[model samples]
Target: MKRMIVRMTLPLLIVCLAFSSFSASARAASEEKYWDHWIERHAQPLDASNASNKDLRFLKKVLKGKRIVQLGETTHGAGEINATKVRMIKYLHEELGYDVLAFESGFPDTNASYLNMDQLTPKSTMKNSIYAVWHTEDVVELFDYMKEQKEKGDPLILTGFDIQSMKNSFNVAATQWVKAVDPEKAELLSQSENDFSTLVTDSNTFDEFSQKKEKLVKNYQKLIKFTKTHASELKENLPKEPKAYEMFMHSLQLRIDVMETYMLEEMKEKLEEYPENIEDFSFFMRDRMMAEQFQWVADTLYPKKKIIVWGHNYHLRKQNTKMIKDWVQLNGPNMGDYLPERLKKQTYTIGIYAYSGASLDSSDNKTVKPVTSPPPSGSLEALLKAADRPAVFVDFLHTKNKKGTSWMYTPRTALYWGYMEEQMILKEQYDGVIWLEHITPSVIIK
Candidate 1:
């Protein structure tokens, strides 16, 4: 009986091993074929040396008729990606007539940027308005180019859609609000400003800001009431500059809202013994604000003109299933996640990828360093690198070869904030992709 049982088990084990080997071989073959087909059919090689007329023509064909083109980078501080983005911006502007450069900086500060780009140098404008990481040579060059274009009768607008306005804008807006309506409240508002300013100045983190919870909420309520009371008069006074007035008020409101939102969350964290899900709440608030700003720019400000958006991939991706599911433990959405509902087919998101190279470690203040790890297997980056192209733009959303897109919805690697998440759905997240063979860090132009 023992001999018979052993003999049967050995045969069964052999059969199982054979099946496993066959399945592995089949999967490998299928993956290889997928890469080859995508490269052959959809990938458009880009010229690295110069913006050849042919290169511009190809990009125009890809971007033609798109009302909003969002360009995303794998990392925040990669110079090579920014350089490529600058190239794309020029092509989109000159050839495709994209008029607005919507950035991921502070909303209030962008007003400073647009007003000063013509009167000031790129460096000065950037330092005054844009984020620190964006103060690069390539960004400065972009500003200079935009300024030249505006001077030649083709006006280009510089705007931002983020909520991280610096302290100066907060003080200015509050002072204006007080002086305009109730001068008696000037001292009260100044005290609030000084309190907030002291917190920001004394510490790098939001600990102090969070500690002054009641003050933030009180200020926000005050501003909201003030805006409501003077809404009609303010709108009437700026007939020719209604958009400017709208933007100013919106910025002020958003700054207070964001600060108060954080402070509330901080209180909740401190109060709760076991905190409830705030991931969705926090993420939704920020992204929702950004989406509102973008909608304002596209629908309210420039309905007829195309806009070019620059930001990190996570912020720009149309779908954020993995992030929402993992972070919030629910199916919440993000900036691109919300925008598509309002903008529909007009929204086009392009995610940039790289096989391997160095990027600035934003976690540290460290400069250029190699990637933390190689592209994981079965990732979008791996598949793109397998295509054997140095530089290529693959339009997954509108590709004629639908077979190439079959693998897109699969969760893949997304490098964000000096870390990697290996579950981002490519096809759902972005409309297209720009794959670079190598990467380099952005230069700190101090």
Candidate 2:
């Protein structure tokens, strides 16, 4: 009698285990279906030349009342991401009222491009001011569109917020502006420009910059002094371009602050036997300054206009902490994280990610290689792909709290710089995400 009872109980236990597995699978399918309902499947990532805004009409509601929209990419070398950004930028400028398009590039260089847009060709303006990583055919098309719009009486302003100097545009623009106002004072600026240019072109790393810290600091100080002393004359001479002069002064001061911060971090690294949080010191300073520079653009430069920010995902995400190498902690707050409360309330961040295929790896900006891989199991990219869409935009901010979308609130793996997986809560990091089923290398223009 005891053996018969045990046999019947074992069968009952097996049936219960089978039912549990089936129920879990059913829940997962239900969750995926829920995500599918919120996914905008009609949108396509097209460049300005090929885009039609009918599919993008959805953005009007998504970005309503948002003064600044930051567009982020997984890497700098994805062709689809660049094309998608150009299309969105065109939509923002034409359909919406966003007039300023800011980049993650040199402040002075990009402004110089804007001031001289009529004199310089679109391609030349892009190459001279924007960073080389963005020197792609897609961006050139967008530049062409900007010029076209300018010719038609509507203008889209181009600017940047980075502290690092780019090319020789800053040096040329600074000296020329001073000469036009006060010829005698131009000599002092020219000398500082010469020194600063050497520091910009010669140094590509922290150690190199550290070696020239004293000279770098001195040059910026002298430049700042000249700008302050002759502010009246400079503004008076350029009545039509008063904002230009103001921004130039702001750039000089911001650059010096950034350099000083770097120098202090370097000093600590050298003096301390064990620097506890030295690994991310420069990144912290850079991101903080970038945020401040962006704020200046919004509040001071284009106070009444909506703005678009173009940058990498790592720099634009809202979260402050991340784990590197699965052990080491990264506590550096990104540019988005450092944004002021006022701006944060009106900002919408969108991150670009790919499900599979090769991304161009131009880490050194010299030789390009391909990083080919598929999304790992249980990654955000994988989950999006499971929705069975070639391309989609998930509006996490609006849908994450809905029933069956609880998966978005939990930590999940996502591809980051160099296609490495990092775990983050999707809804917390970005307002929305553009996911591509496959991506190819960006067309690098020579």
Candidate 3:
């Protein structure tokens, strides 16, 4: 009787195991079917030119009533991503009425270049104002496009929202503004200008910068206080350029705030407080300042105009990941994360990624680094690559909570220069994603 009972139990256990295996296989097939259908239903093919911009018509519905649209790249060195962004910028400008194109570049230099865009060629304007990392052939094409539109009487105003003075252009531009506004006060700014130029261009490390931090802070404070004290007179002096005056004053204040924040980070280290990783304070402050600059653009400068923002995915992502939280415990919010609730509601962000490609190394922008391996199996890039499209844009807003695509809600990694990091909830991080099956390094403009 015991032997018979044992035999029966063993057979039943085998049957249960077989059924479980069948169920797992069936679930995987269903998921695959869902993803295939979803891609076919929603993926928009990316066109490189505005001539066939009908492919981008879907954006009209997705971005309806949006005031600010942010286009972000995984890295700064992808040629295809830059080309695709230019096409989107054209559509946003012509079809959607986004007239302002703000970059992740120097606030002072970019505005000065825009003010004198008529006198300068596109290449010169880009070279003098924007960061060298973005000095690519594809971006040059954008400057050319902006020039063409200005000629056609549909001007796309160029500006930037960064606090860091990337070049000496800022020093020249800022000093000129002060001289034009108040000649007597111009010398006060000149001192600060020289100090800042040295801080940005000469100091290569925090250690080097620390030695000059006190003097730089003192000079910047004096200049900022002087500017505030004579604000009304300065505005009156620039009667014909009230908006420019306001922006100039605000840029000066922001620069000082950035300097003070760096000083605070150094102080924290000296005090032996939050000693785990004090650099996070400076990183957080930079993004916070960037968000403030963007807000000033959206609310103060271009209140009625639609704006387009171009920047890195790391800076523009609205959501924070476990990695970021762990890494930046003191203050980890990104530029997008710092945006006010009202502006966030009216904003749409798109993150661009690639499954496989080579990119210019971020360290030097000259070294070519080939993608040594395919995207991880569960990454967002891998999922998109499985769709087998050369390039496609997937709208995360509409696809959430759908059948067979629950993977959208789950944590997954995304490719960054052919590498993966800790998983993040992709749907939360971006409103949409543009995936390139393959990419090449940006052609750096010499």
Candidate 4:
């Protein structure tokens, strides 16, 4: 009788605790939603005074001196009404005394050998892989202003990845030319190899801008026509020496492809050196880009200078710190873990994120859901590790909501049914990161 009573009471006690915890989490989420409502409810522009003294104090702490402050937004802003962005910048420069202005459109760390972010120019106003031409307005506006400052002698130490066509061993200069006797005959395709060289060498000497543009068009046309003629003759002779002919053509076409068109690049050849699978590819690239960026910043930019960096919130997401994990554990003279001897621990990385995105909820990508009060700041695996009082709740509540599955119920039905793998990819390395979520996406799924 005594054993039976103890067994039954223990389960009842567990059910009660779970019920209370769920209720607390739900209430905390509701409070977050309410505060967010108050923050954005105002239509007034974000001004210096609109921010609190605490805001500036925090800014000062985060961005004092040559610290790198990276603000990652998925896309550029629109129109003149980007109040939030404008205010954010103002707080950094004015309150924090930040001297350098950096951009995520390019590299944020002061690494000269850093690989520049690729700038894709769309053929039209639409979007594509290589060029996000339409979204380029923000980059153009920001860089144009910076370039103007450089020209005025109030220069900034501007650094980022350049988006020039790497395929071109020679760029616009290869196609642009100097003047000939007249427009039509002068612009004619040059069959003379020396003429092509001369044109590219002295293209700047061409007075009229139109003259330079016309030369480029003619240069490509000439090459294309010449290739077509040669390829036809080779085809007729191909039955006897097809392999040799094909090899010759391949070499020739490659030249034109690089210096002329925006065709498929050498990603395949590069990929060939790595695992072909997507999981392997993503992890490999993530590590490679992260390492390359780190080496470029620390070694190339400043051997003995203090710096700051802003990157994707993902880089600093404490719970899901996948990007920097391998790098942190990396032990070497030039690894993320290895601080330079000259620098005695002034280096730090801070992550900032708005806890807003189409995350756990299946709704609009930009939809804002409530931020549940954080679970008692315990690792998800802690319950498995410590089994004194609380029973593990991995599958205890999966059937409570179809859209939002709690880790309680549905898990036991299937082996390894949790999103543990995806979640682990998110939590890895960081100093301290802030979680914020905006509540003003066009739709809210209550």
Q: State each model's CA lDDT, in order.
A: 0.69, 0.74, 0.76, 0.32
Tens-place lDDT per residue, model 3, 1-446, is 99999998999999999998677546655576577677766688876644878889999999988988999988788898888898899889989999999999978878877766666788987887788888888888888888788778888988898877764676666666678767666776666666766564465566676667667667667767777887776666542433667667776776677666754564554554453543366667677788888988999988998999999887887765333322234325778778899999889999998888888876788998775357777677878866677889988877756555756766566765666454566777888999988889988887
Q: lDDT tens string, model 2, 1-446?
A: 99999999999989999998687556655676565444434233322343466767778998988999999988888787888888889889989989889999989889877777777889998888888888889999999998888779788888998876764777666777788877766776667656655653455665676778677677678777877887887766542543778777876776667557744564444544234663357657678878888988999888998999999888887765642321124546778777888998899999888887666665655454443356676677776765575677767766635545655765577777436767777787888888877777777788
Q: Mind giving the per-residue lDDT tens digits that candidate 4 earns over 324-348?
A: 2222232112122223333323433
| Model 3 residue 284 distance off true place after TM-score fit, in angstroms | 2.2
Residues 1-446, candidate 1, lDDT per residue (tens digit)? Answer: 99999998999999999998677546544665666676766678777686465754766666666788999987877877888898888888877888888999877778655654565777777776777787789888888887788789786678888866655644544455456556655566656656654544454444554556456657756766776687775554332332656665666566566666643453444444233553435556677778877887788777887889999887788766545233234546667766747585887889887877888866553666676456676666667765677888888777642444556644455555334544655666778998887877888788
The CA-based lDDT of model 4 is what?
0.32
TM-score of each: 0.78, 0.82, 0.82, 0.37
As for candidate 2, its clashing pairs are: none
Off by over 4 Å in 4: 1-54, 63-66, 73-141, 144-154, 161-283, 302-310, 315-352, 355-446
Best model per lDDT: 3
The model with the greater lDDT, 2 or 3, is 3
Task: RMSD for all candidates, in order, please.
Answer: 7.0, 8.1, 7.6, 18.6
Q: In candidate 1, which residue ranges exceed 4 Å CA deviation?
A: 1-31, 169-242, 270-275, 278-284, 322-332, 367-369, 372-374, 400-405, 409-411, 417-421
The global Cα lDDT (0 to 1) of model 3 is 0.76
